[model samples]
Target: MSIKMMPYLILDGNGAEAVAFYVKALGAEVMALQTFGGMPQSPDQPVPDEAKDRVANAQLSIGGAEFMLSDNYPGMAYQLGDQVSVCIITNSKEDSEALFNALADEGTIHMAFQETFWSPGYGIVTDKFGVNFQISTEA
Candidate 1:
């Protein structure tokens, strides 16, 4: 199974600005972008007008490496040093599980391995070295 690792950055609310900056500063290409307002929502979960412009997800490729960015949901607090995570994408479920378990040892499990809308198995963990990781099988 092929595995790819990429850095994911959480921008408090400046994802659009960040994407624009990266495009000019690093010659990055914006691969995809989705806004919070673009997603389907129930009536009870209406999106606020202010958040309509917030980026729900954005992908950029810089120097042949891909990175993801997203604006934090409204009311979500973000701080420096905690805004970055390594995203591990694997093609095999077994590989994803193995990696998740190995990293969970002596580490904190921020999210347990489980099926998610985006992947067959996904989870988050902070390794022994304090590096945050998001492990998942390819969607």
Candidate 2:
């Protein structure tokens, strides 16, 4: 048996916004979204209206890649860190163009997603939520 390692992000109650941003930026598909706010609760502990829509988990896909997100845990700080990032290697020039544009719309492009001397196509951007990403396509 083999196990695949997918990057997981723990947002500070910003999973939904991050997911929406990724959908636009990476053309990522929402594979699944589990929210504590949307689940049935016990009569003793009813789901709070404020938290009902808060995401418990979300799975997003870009091409064959996937990542997970969550907003259920509280008291967690999401300040920028250099611990993790998703490096996306695009499948085609079109994919690279569209995703790079979308990600750059409201985020910082660390290194412009353009042709590099070493690679055919490449770019780097930090999404709106401060998640760093690397995008590239073959020549």
Against the true structure, whose TM-score is highest?
A: 1
Off by over 4 Å in 1: 40-51
**Cα displacement (Å) at residue 9, model 1:** 1.2
Worst 10 residues of 1 by lDDT: 72-81
Writing each residue's lDDT as its tens digit, candidate 1 over 23-116 gives 9999999999999988777598799888889998799998888999889888766778889999999998889999999999999998899987
Clashes of each: 0, 2
| Model 1: number of backbone collisions | 0
* lDDT of model 2 at position 138: 57
- lDDT value, residue 34 of candidate 1: 91
TM agreement with the true structure for every prediction: 0.83, 0.50
Compared with the true structure, all predictions reach lDDT values of 0.90, 0.72
